[model samples]
Target: MRCHPLLPAWRAAARCLGALALLGAAVVARGQGVGAGVGGEAEIAAVGAQVQQLARDSAGRAGLRDARIEVEVGQLDPRLKLAPCQRIEPYLPPGLPVWGRTRIGLKCTQGPKPWNVTLPVTVHVYARSLVTQAALAAGTTLAPEHFTEAEVDLAAAPGLPIGQPGLAVGRTLARPLAAGSALRAADLKARQFFAAGETVRVVAGGPGWQVVTEAEAMNPGLEGQTVRVRTESGRLLQGRPVGDRQVEVML
Candidate 1:
């Protein structure tokens, strides 16, 4: 009897093939143990779009017009194994608030695993606002030539920008305003109607009887505000201003 010379070579080839099969099985088992996570560009877009739309829908209420909304989303945990989501809902977290920097919520539903997450968002409201063209003193009364209408990002600028030309026109600044500054309601004071020692018509009555008397204003006031006035008989009375120069009192 004699042994074939090729027998050893064939046996070695069989052993190599078995070893390769075992290595592949090990890789498959490890992959199954580690869960697959949802992430990357495509998934991010789907989630971000949902949040962006919610922002746009509420833009008008934020005083934003023709707004451009942009969003960025972070990746989920690599170890998470979320089932395929059929619906994704994004909204503001609880407080019904949206401003410069805010949070957006994401909820996934109609899937094997339902989950929620929060993302950071920045909102920019762009529109035409009245801003000072040059530095002006505290008492400087604003006019068309003093300021210019400029398109501004309201989120970055502190205080509300003057919305209309009529708002800033002929209005006295409450404090010194810098050049190219966004103007707010707090920046200016309304023109005074009743100044100290100024005589004003005071009408007091209701229903059927009316009495009109001339009195001196002890304190200056804006239209529709209360002012203390001194009458001819030395009576100090509080009255509600009904017009630009008139105050009314109920008897």
Candidate 2:
């Protein structure tokens, strides 16, 4: 075979290009594998700190005065072989709250082989709330002396804790409350506005008309709660309590 005049030069250029490509691939492989100084635990810790900062930012915006925020990050997957990242950046996860149980995203944005992950994060937002000051019997209505306001971890509460001292002032306890116990929504029920089987006035009209009738309460119910009532003519209906002895039904 006859060789062209520029064949030798072309061969040299191709060989140089092939060597450079091989070197580039080797460098990327080294980075993707277990690079000595890169530690998964370290990355996890960095991600955790970032999550805590983000949680604190949320507390400030929420106007929750004197709130204490604590963040806990879960362990990373051991089977994940993430490339050693130059910068492990943190970002907020969509549709998740930063105050309670949530998740945070961490990514290697500037690394040779970029990667990302979602880790479980828990934020304990503590704030002041009212709690029982002494053991109270069930059915005992709350008074000013029943509880006092104190700082408590809202995240750990069984239900939403009473924030204002007056919120517990007139509600009756569902069960006996222990001294110094947090006051959750499950702990109390609103006082019965009217006695069961008692005759009460119900307004049964809406926008255009007003019809007043009498009803007998089948069970005790609180204001704003639905109660079963028997009409004067023996018709059964459900209505919302409007006052101490008033029920209102939608037309």
Candidate 3:
């Protein structure tokens, strides 16, 4: 396959995968003869290939080039019958990412009965990530020894898994996690820097300029989370918590 000059490596690879899927569909459709519905197995396999490629491309784009990826393509509903098609296209449904349990789209382009259906899919992305060494209860402040690194499926649950010791250390768990479970950002509690009605420093800065003021936090200021504040003049604004009782707003 030739790479497009305008496309990145992952995009070029995606194009190649799409072309291969089309070619595979054509070959299988021919074997089924003209005016016959594409074989369900063949169609499912094509969708599976596309989904696997998508997960790999996505991981590559995210700088996980060496990450191990596994894709599981599921069966279509038995109650539904397919249509005769000369061409079938597999696609990722918009807004539905290839993470964990998801679906792949299969549409008949040149079929006697135009039809589209979703095939169940599960994308498992395995990499070195932090996992609890033992069952920990909620509110446990994480320490270096609390968790250890292991190769686990990042998409086995929601939220991005924590890989670095610095990210997991000193953070409190929001919920109890079982031993050997992958630790994710969602598993940690949001750190509260300032409580509601507290006067917090607000810093707004732009190129070559910086402004600092104090405002009353309308809501609790949680680390890396947005907090609503009212300035001295009662001007309401939103900013992200950067530090203890500190908020930053980009102008």
Candidate 4:
């Protein structure tokens, strides 16, 4: 018979089947172990409590309310030694929708060795409101017409300690300012006016004169002449010596 060839083929088939069986058994055992470890309700609850405390602490620091929070628990692993607070998500309060998300993680001491755990969490806060107030008129107080827009500064609102300056909330003006509106400090036009005791170059018909005056004025002097100056009632005497600032006029 042809038994030689058939024997080798049978042995190969048997070896393959045995290897598959071992692999299957190992897979099943590993799955069961994981399921059992996760099934410990008491340990999961304890870990959940720790996560809740972390959430509370973070919310307090952020000036958020506890009621506006939601917490979810994940399976605890023996390898996990760190806080999983990052997994928590807080609920938003009424009259407010989700604005943004913030993540936080912490670590607690369980024993000598530390385990790295992560908590995937989310925090929800109220949507900011916008309110605008415009500057009051000189004689009139603030009225509805004074405000042009309404908005709030969201970043500064959160995490504010009590008695600290609260968030700056307001709206922006929509339209251009009315004509003839009262001028603010920023609106005033700066004019450079001549001051007393300042030196000024005087140009007349001839030579340029440099005049240092104790008073403020554009003194009438000739271009190319030097003048002796005397001040009477903030005015320069016309008939004076020739110099830079003052010029002598021939009478």
Candidate 5:
């Protein structure tokens, strides 16, 4: 028996409805995908704007009145199995433009991947011109020597006792000393007498007689006189004097 002609029309209508339903589903899926991509881009742009605003605020606080600035955001990693908006670009300070391609690692919720997304931006400022003009008008230049290290010698001469001016070795003497005469070191000598706030003594002269100390007292004793020296054991011994309060005793 032959099938009814109305059955063929019903079958055709069913096939058409199935195709239309699939087409509608595909259109809806494509729209959703496009919306998601656009949302991600909008989020990145919003982040970039926020970062730019912060940079502007900081520059204002830093006394930079005429600085131009910008901010960019992009993915740090692409192979990361995270959300599309998980990565972000870093904030770059205003400076001279860097030429050529450069890569920098960014911190993101996405897994680590180098140079996945990058942004290049240019910032120009009029402050540099003002600075250059000011430097030129001042007629000055900074040099490395301006920041160099310095040294001072504390052990050198002219480092004298407190409240006492240092006397030159050959100057300030009451009697002339011969050029080749040897003097004992100041620490090894002993004081024979004390007068006028100074120690007057005889220093070792070599074999025959003792040399007089060079220290000058305010009240000097007569030359070629005799003085009494009290030994460490409290014995008073007569000593022949030479100059100032200096004296020589028999060894």
Candidate 6:
């Protein structure tokens, strides 16, 4: 029999959906097995709630009070049957930050068979921050018009987000960024006051005394960064870049 042109496509999609449903059922069955032994489903659910509260507390301690925090606790592995735990202690793994994707360790302290397991968790910390208004290329000097404020998940990426437009304005981008992407402090290039081999004024100030002298910069003088400069006497001194072609040296 002849079939409709779209019939095969529809059949293929139906088969995919059926396979997905079967896979979902298998996962549910496996999850049921996980809680069948020691603590059971109710205890497992309680543990997840406790872990979530712990995550929220950690975020608050990290000074994310104004930020919207969301936590997702993963299910335990179904393969290992848990023993009846008289006390299940949930703790943050040592040296693991509570931000981003992290794990919470659960140990059976007073059980016949002591068991330790970790549940994966995803932490979302959302805050209002500046983001690119349009796709920007590397070396593009940032301006107020180039950014817009949006709610961004800070834990999704490293580096702190630039909150004020003035903080990022006049800075060049270090790399290309997609439109609507969060603007981070690390995304801007270090402010270059003077390049290496350039002449700069070295300002030295002491109690009731100030000395200004010219020196040759041995390396690029970036804002807030220290650079070595050779004075007229050929003595090398470390100074921080303060302005264009200027370095500040402490007495």
Winning model by TM-score: 3
Top lDDT hit: 3
Provide the TM-score for each candidate, comma-separated: 0.49, 0.60, 0.76, 0.21, 0.24, 0.63
Worst 10 residues of 2 by lDDT: 1-10
* Each prediction's whole-model lDDT (CA): 0.60, 0.63, 0.70, 0.31, 0.32, 0.67
Candidate 3 least-lDDT 10 residues: 1-10
| Segments in model 6 whose C-alpha atoms lie over 4 Å from true places | 1-66, 82-89, 108-114, 199-216, 223-226, 230-251
Worst 10 residues of 4 by lDDT: 160-169
For 1-251, candidate 3 gives per-residue lDDT tens digits of 11111123234334434443454445345434423333467666765676567657765775666666666656656656566677778777787654567765777888788878776656666776678899999999999888776778766776667667786788899999999998878888988999999999999999999999999999999876789999999999999998889999888
RMSD of each: 24.0, 20.4, 6.2, 30.6, 36.2, 14.8
State the displacement of the C-alpha of residue 250, model 4, in Å, after optimal TM-score superposition.
61
Give per-residue CA lDDT, model 5, range 117-220, as digits (tens).
22333221111210011111111232221121112111111211111112122222232322222111221122234454344564545577664444334442
RMSD of 3: 6.2
- Model 5's number of clashes is 0
Clash totals for all candidate models? 0, 0, 0, 37, 0, 0
Give me the overall lDDT of model 1.
0.60
> Candidate 2 — what's its lDDT?
0.63
Candidate 3 lDDT for residue 48: 61
Q: Relative to the unseen true structure, what is the C-alpha lDDT of residue 63 in candidate 2, on a scale of 0 to 100? A: 49
Compared with the true structure, model 4 gives a TM-score of 0.21
Candidates ranked, most accurate by lDDT first: 3, 6, 2, 1, 5, 4
**Between candidates 4 and 5, which one is better according to lDDT?**
5
lDDT string for model 2 (188-233, tens) is: 7755789898888988987889999888999886855789999978
Candidate 2 regions off by >4 Å?
A: 1-39, 77-118, 135-141, 203-213, 222-225, 232-236
